[model samples]
Target: MDLNYYDTLIAVADDCPVNGAVVPALRGGKKTVAVVQFDMISADPGGLTQEDVLFETWLRRRESDGLSESERAELRAQFFSRSQACLRASPLPKKYGWGLRFDAAGRVTLCPMGSDEYEEIIAGEVPGVNVLKAMRSKRA
Candidate 1:
């Protein structure tokens, strides 16, 4: 169960409303999945793999109070043991107008839509990088 992409850029969805990447805001007093994902990537661009991002997002939201280090590790193992959706379903690309670039090592970085880097990737100027669009928000 590996959830990593290499030398790839996940472009924004076709129905994305923004012209450029917009930082996701907290929902009420809580962090949304989009916010968590954005923060993690923003804090360490190209440092986290897709599995890291997804698991952290789940962990941050879970009530893990009083859990020991080994307990947390076990929980993490259980989390990834099940099927998980990839970043293509993530709101960063599907709604927030950001792109996800996975490097050769499968570490992810953000590419804001409408940015020069994003344009280069979309235009195939970034050699060896394949482009994939985020999943659509609505059915046809």
Candidate 2:
């Protein structure tokens, strides 16, 4: 995980939809975006970029995609910008009704939108923290 991917100030979005965008292409099938992201974030407290998760997912689907380490690194670098466009746009915040929160250490954790913690955080009642909602798909 990279520190660049960590944000001390978290994004908490409510009223979002569950859009299955980051799901891995698997042999039997794919898991939901929430399942993938949660597992990835949980594995490392440092947090990961959308690309990190996506790359892992892609590898899960095709380990023999055939790219050298250098090539893979280059592709991953390019993937950052590309992934940014998809990450915040993820269904985790866009539709799954989960709030993404970062600790002082910059690790991310999910808060169900229906949870009291989400309400307190969203209301700014939580001390020493900031939250931003996910962007809506269309005009409100």
Candidate 3:
């Protein structure tokens, strides 16, 4: 399934406690999904699609060091063969105070909560940009 969000901005969760986007830190000497996602997106803004981010994060965390190209392709197919949660459930927006913006081409970039871009997105000042909030942490 294609999981790209075009011309959309996913704002931070309402219950996010941080005032701005914070880099996700290593946990227990290992990179969590949030850290991986943050590192990938922050490294190259608008360079990756949501599917690329999710699959690469999952692949990196696995033991596929010597897999052949076909094997890797198979793995990717298996990974995406089932339903996957989108970025709205991601910790970057729900916990790390970052907004996710998808351009018309479906490439994604991180927008920190207090950044000018984030402000513009949430305020509906950016044309053709649909805004949605990340899933809340608490049940209300």
Candidate 4:
């Protein structure tokens, strides 16, 4: 398992493996939880591609917003406290994975990484927003 990729996944998901939830709010506030599962089409074992790294980084950056001081503290604590546990709980599969998004309602949405979609995203296509336009632009 790629420790770096696992770390990146945890950083993006923001969920603790031990508690199965976002680290509790230190000062008491709201926190979002995201679950990213990678889906590889091929059965062959290999490491993540450069595109995966870029996409994951972009996803993490997009999620970092409006966090209060206490919330930030909780995140830090959880990251440190459950780092090992998280690694054990969610090991990245050698093949394809799906990214799950959990909102305040705890609903999980599967985010598919279609090749064209991924390319568009890399080219600055905002998923669910400008996907069509992005796709069209790729042809232009």
In terms of TM-score, the best-performing candidate is: 3
Return the candidate ranking by TM-score, descending: 3, 1, 2, 4
- lDDT by residue (1-140, candidate 2, tens digit) is 35333433334344454422233233346566556665676677456544566665555445447788998887667655453443455556665555666666555666666567777877778887766667675676
What is the C-alpha lDDT profile of model 1 across 5-58, one tens digit per residue? 999999999999888889999889889999989999999998999989988889
Q: Model 3: per-residue lDDT, tens digit, 78-132?
A: 9999999889989999999999999999999998899998997788888899998
Pitting candidate 2 against candidate 4, the one with the higher lDDT is: 2
Between candidates 2 and 4, the TM-score winner: 2
Best candidate (score: lDDT) = 1
Report how far off residue 78 is in candidate 3 (Å): 0.8
lDDT for residue 51 in candidate 1, whole number 0-100: 89
Could you tell me which residue pairs clash in candidate 1?
A: none
- Estimate the overall C-alpha local distance difference test score of candidate 3: 0.91
Q: Between the candidate structures 1 and 2, which one is better when assessed by lDDT?
A: 1
Ten-residue stretch with the least lDDT total in model 3: 58-67
Each model's backbone clash number: 0, 4, 0, 8
User: TM-score of model 3 relative to the true fold?
Assistant: 0.94
TM-score of model 1 relative to the true fold? 0.94
Give Cα distance to truth, residue 133, candidate 2, Å.
0.4
* Superposed Cα RMSD, model 3: 1.1
